[model samples]
Target chain A: MECYSELTCSLFVDGELTGDAARHLRDHLVTCQRCRDLVHALRAESRVLTESLRELPEEAPSPEAFSHLGFSWVWGDLAMMAAVLALGSTLFIWIDHLEIPGALEWFNPFSLNGLTNLMFNLSYYFAHGGTAMLTEYVAVVGGLFLVLLLGGSVLLLGRRWRLPKNGLGLLIVLLTFSLPGFALERRHEEFVTIAANQTVDDTLLAIGNTVRVEGVVNGDLLAFGRSVEVSGTVKGDLVSFAKRTVVSGSVEGRIYNFSQSLDLDGQLGHSIYGFTQSLRVADRGHVGDGIVAAAGDVSLEGEVKRSVDMLLSGNADLSGSIGRDMTVTGRGLTLTNTARVGGNLTARVRQLKGVHIADGAIIAGKRDVQVRVRKSQFARSRFYFRQALSFASAMLVGWLGLVLVPGFFRETTQAVGSGWRSLGLGIGILAGVPVAIVVVAITLVGIPIALMLFAAYLTAIYLAKIWVGAFLGWILLRPTGATRYDWLLGLLLGLLILTIVGFIPYLGGLVRFGIVCLGLGAFAWQLYHASRPAMTA
Target chain B: MIVEVEEGVVVEATSSEPSPLGAVIRMEERAQLRVAIAHLPENYRLPLVLRYYSELSYDEIAQQLGLRRNHVAVLILRAKQELRRKLAHRSK
Candidate 1:
């Protein structure tokens, strides 16, 4: 008799042979020794195959090898949240400083009667000022977000391509050299001077120990030096980064100054924006537009045709005329007798006693004095409302994360298994990044990199809580067979628990901090592993 | 054929008891099997490994390899046949 097919015997041994075929094979095996031996051989072969394959050492390195380090990928939703918060805060500060007519009254959270009122006010603002605001801020914010998203996607998805060690350096170099309008005149010397009679029709980029521009620069003047003295006419903008910047010449365009000391005795057709230790607008100096400065000390004796917005750490003394609104925030403010304001005068000081208005000081419009109050942030209902808003925003972000990168989201949550290691790494990263940022920023060449790092740092901090929440949710729901939208459910439950825990008076902060540390560490660990060359299976 | 049956019985007995000498022999056999599997063509080896090592079902292996379920079974069987032939030839 013909022996049963070996394929049937293999299938039978694998428990894949079923129904009548399996029954028939079993019945035949009772009588046929040859077929029985074939079946036995196949079973033995299967056992050997399984044992040999299972006993083979794993090709990939053990996860325990780098369990001490935590990893993280830049999450899109977190990035978006960071971007929106940054943009909103900047806009609020700008509007608050500019004291735009009626804008503050609408945004006053304390004045709102209830949630309905706040919502109504917000909707009203969106309806009325949305177009102007969106056009001004949204375009820039959207473009930046789009670029970030694209870059992040590439980094996350492009596993096949590896960036070389010096890739970022190469990119920076290429970008610097390949910028549009690369025909600008470059000057680097110990003491560079554009003599009085000379005329430069093109933009002048200068770096020196002391840069003196006494001649005409028909275009923008980009100056970097220990001391920058611009005594000549600059038809275009003047951007100066120096220890001491003195502008005694007429500049048709805006003046952007980053210096320790800025003395503006020159005529400025537009605004003067300065980040300086001390800013002085001399008696003869005049600004056609506004003066926006963040300085340690501000002495404004000149006339500003538009507005004067200043954030002073030390003191501000204004004796000159302001064409429109004048807003000053500082330790102390002084309005001299000769000080004249065409519009509103708003002073924000630590104490009302810090503001001094002379009897002869003229104000054409409203004079509002705001004294800073020190109180517990949690005491305010607005604080709770803000917290609720934050929770909702986080939920939205978490949902987006779950929808976009489910695999990564799950992996990141699972990575939190090494709790102590993640916490330790998180603590290191949280404390070390700022120090690294400062070091990088000190090298002016790395300013862009420093900014990028700062953004990433903020994004990571915001994302830490979400990661913890997701992990918590997973842990709680794992026994329930969390297979469908498990991450979303986990995130929701985890975030709710975290929020409740955070409301606990004294222990809440400590618990929250620990959670953040764990999340950060896990992310860092995952990020490190992700960046490594993947092991071939 | 009778000798092959006796060899099968010895293998089954050795695997169950695994004495020191039997363990050594089993290790050598496993090493030989690994080499034979590695030498098998990708078409057969992939399905076999996916079934035995990964512990994937035939349907899953078919889905992963984008082959029919029956095709996956056939490929696995062929892979085992090839491995057995290699091992037998080496022993000879």
Candidate 2:
């Protein structure tokens, strides 16, 4: 018989050979020295192979070794989210309660006329507020929140996602220095004083008890103090936030002032916009452009080369020469004998008798007086119609979300089981993101990012209620045979319920806020969980 | 000359003649052989390891690998051959 095949010898070494085969191989090996050597070598090879494999480490470390580390990391992410949320909500509530100067006091939500007035006032403020409106506290807090959010996200998510380590380091460094506190350290000057002979070529920022500029400033002047006095020449805009602002200089650009009282005794190349308690233009004051002010009392004794628009809470006394139209909405208006309006004079006051014009006061164009009237917003059919339209639009958005990302809703709804946790996360994201966006916008280079963030923030806010509505609908219906259509039906019912609750005077606002918190929290929770690495083998 | 195995002991074909090859492998040679086996391909390595390291029978290896009984035997033989070649090349 031929020598046993190496395959047969290997099987024999493993003791896998059957009775007849094993007996034959053993008999063959004894007679053939070559086969015997083959058998011996095979057995030795088998022993070595088994020992080597047994000594080798597993391909991946056992899951038990990493389970604890992974769990802690997940909890770390959750804690970070909660902390940021709490801090953000506190800041938001504080900012909301702040009594901003020049804010409309006649902002009656129950009147359509009041809404129109609010829109007009908001447009005016946005158009003229300029950089002075950006509060320092907001900028600082926003910067800090931005750094924490971005840095935390990268650090927490980077390892699991295997993001490039070098890039993460660079990003962390960039986020650290982007804080407004760091930037302010280099640019802020406390108790700034520019001497008579001094000239500042770069934009000047001064924040202290008092800011006095007596020389030339080639760039914009930003001053925030108890008292801001500028008796110099400003080649660019002058933005001042102070208790009292007095300008006796020539400003080549516009003037934006938010103060208790603003006195202009200088030449303005452009417009003068002031949100103040009292604003006065002295006899020597000359404005090349228009004058726009929201003030308690406005007295113009100088000359304005363009129109004058004033929203007053007390009264407007115009003794100066206005080259264009004059529009005043206030408690009362007065035009002295020296007052000269080259164009139309329009006054909207509490009463027509509140407008007093001297016989000698020259108005070259039409003079119109409108008596203000209060109307109930709920009385108007248009209000209900508008509300319906808004409701429909919201429903459309919710429907789209449901259709396109059903999985997302499922995940969010699942997270809603942890209610308080979701609420905390929700408050943080809602309040924190806007502040971060504002801070980013303050940095000119980050404007695009700010815009994108703003869009996302608005979308999140709009969707918050819808997400909650869907969850509510699902709970109430609890269809035995659930389907896509069943979810839609539940969504409709839930939205209807929410809408009715939202119409309930005082409780509506509170319920709406709760729903938003719940929805936003659940959404954020889902996102966090989704970002976790897949640990299952 | 005739050789026969009555039970476990080997009776040489020629009386008073000892075995030509050494049955016992040295510790260093066994270590070297183990390293060679580790370097074997997955198809060969897996069955070889399963058979020896795991102390599985041919039927068990075939069940794990989803292969025929005879095919497993062939793979193990190839695995041993590859390991021998590697060890020989390393010694050179």
In terms of DockQ, which candidate is strongest? 2
Question: What digit string (tens of lDDT, one per residue) describes model 2 on residues A134-179?
Answer: 3332334344555556555544554334435775685576556444
lDDT of 1 at A158: 49
Model 1: per-residue Cα lDDT over A1-537, one tens digit each = 566888878878777778998999899999999999888888778777877766653311223322311121124335545655565465445534432122113222222232345566457678885544433233233333333433343444343243344665656674584342354677766677999999988888776778899999988888777889989999999888788999899899999888889998989999999999999999888899998999999998988899999998988998998899999989888999999999999998988787899999999999998887756877888889998899898888888777786655666677787889898777767655654454333322345656777899888878888889988988888846646377778888999999999979989999899887888878876774554323111
Model 1 residue A341 distance off true place after TM-score fit, in angstroms: 2.1
Candidate 1 steric clashes: 9
Q: Give lDDT tens digits, candidate 2, residues B6-73.
A: 31233232234553343233335555665555446657867776676556788887987789988888
Residue A402 lDDT, candidate 1, scale 0-100:
74
Stretches of candidate 2 off by over 4 Å are A1-73, A78-189, A258-261, A272-280, A291-299, A308-317, A327-334, A340-342, A345-368, A396-419, A422-500, A512-537, B1-92
What is the interface root-mean-square deviation of candidate 1? 8.2
State the DockQ of every prediction: 0.15, 0.17
State TM-scores per candidate.
0.54, 0.53
lDDT over C-alpha atoms for residue A87 of model 2: 58
True-vs-predicted CA distance for residue A252, candidate 1, Å: 3.5
Checking candidate 1 for backbone clashes, the offending pairs are: A70-A524, A70-A525, A71-A523, A71-A524, A71-A525, A71-A526, A71-A527, A72-A523, A72-A527
